[model samples]
Target: MTDTILEVRDLRTSFFTENFEVKAVDGVNFSVPKGKTLGVVGESGSGKSITSLSILRLIQNPGKVVGGQVLFKGEDLLEKSEAQMRKIRGNKISMIFQEPMTSLNPVYTVGQQIGEAFQIHEKLNKKESIKRSVRC
Candidate 1:
């Protein structure tokens, strides 16, 4: 059987605005075993994306992972330094942003934007990945 590659325990992410606090992700727990895939499904604003952002330590200003732990290969990612996280971010771990178009450059075609993404994790050249993306 495959071992647990990633586990999240009681993850809570919060956003603070002038008016009040929004608990985007609260008390979330899950695990992904090696050689396995997990799917998270819920209605909009149900904190699905927020939980992922927290696990990746990509929570931005006004939003923070207030509590809980993200364990990757038995190492607590929450305890890792930013430099350590940086190394892990591109190599050991990665993410696919939810919206493709929002960040796509207006002048570039969708294939061009997606090709850059393949360059990131898949290590394909712009020409090859762009061709692959366009075909898809």
Candidate 2:
């Protein structure tokens, strides 16, 4: 069998609100093979964002990834250290938000922001980085 690139098994995420506990992701399970994509389609508040955030371990206080395993290339992502996950977050797996204006920093030039990606992952020098960033 082909190896699984990403596996999320029985994932559960919850938020402790002032009055009650809100279950954002309830026992969600899926696997994506290499070079494949999984589109999660749901209405707002259907746990789409929470599920993605949980995969990256970015869910903050009040909401937490309470259960399940996030395996990337057969490794348990939930068990990875923050530093390790930081390396993976953008390098191995990159996310582009729906709103580009908001995603980019107004203070920084577009080239600067894009160059940061190459700098972090590929360790490109400034001149070459800007060139590649512009191409991106």
Candidate 3:
């Protein structure tokens, strides 16, 4: 079996504004092998975050993945349907934003929010998810 866990080939993501287009990620490529890690370091606006977002298919509207493929365990994530992506996200593939607290809803407790993620990704009941979240 191959030790390659992820392979991003010629990924290109862009944003279309009314006046112009911004190519956040143009032909980016890399891979993460089993028992290995990869870190991206660059100046701000160098498409670091955008690359991660694209890999997860989380690019917001106005920004889209224009080309290339993200192979995770030999499956092309770019070709997966939204429903399929939903199942893979947070379960098989996960990401942590730079400032994660900003991603959380202030109205919800941190545990509760994490519990929701656990419930959605693991198909655990609310009570069980909440319990698991608390333990973490």
lDDT (C-alpha, whole model) for all candidates: 0.85, 0.89, 0.91
lDDT tens digits by residue: candidate 3, 1-136: 6799999999999999999989999999999998898988999999999999999999998999999999999999999999999999888887877786687788987778788878998788988988999887
Instruction: TM-score for candidate 2, please give it.
Output: 0.88
Error of 2 at 43 (Å): 0.9
Better of 2 and 3 by TM-score: 3
lDDT of 1 at 50: 86
- Counting clashing residue pairs in each candidate, in order, gives 0, 0, 0
Quick one: ranking by lDDT, best first? 3, 2, 1
C-alpha RMSD of each candidate structure in angstroms: 3.3, 1.7, 1.7
Task: Rank candidates by TM-score, best first.
Answer: 3, 2, 1
Tell me the spans in candidate 3 whose CA falls farther than 4 Å from its real position.
Answer: 134-136
| lDDT string, candidate 2, 62-136, tens digits | 998989999999888899999999899878877776677888889988788878878888999877889998787
Stronger candidate by lDDT (1 vs 2):
2
Angstrom error of the Cα, residue 39, model 1: value is 0.5
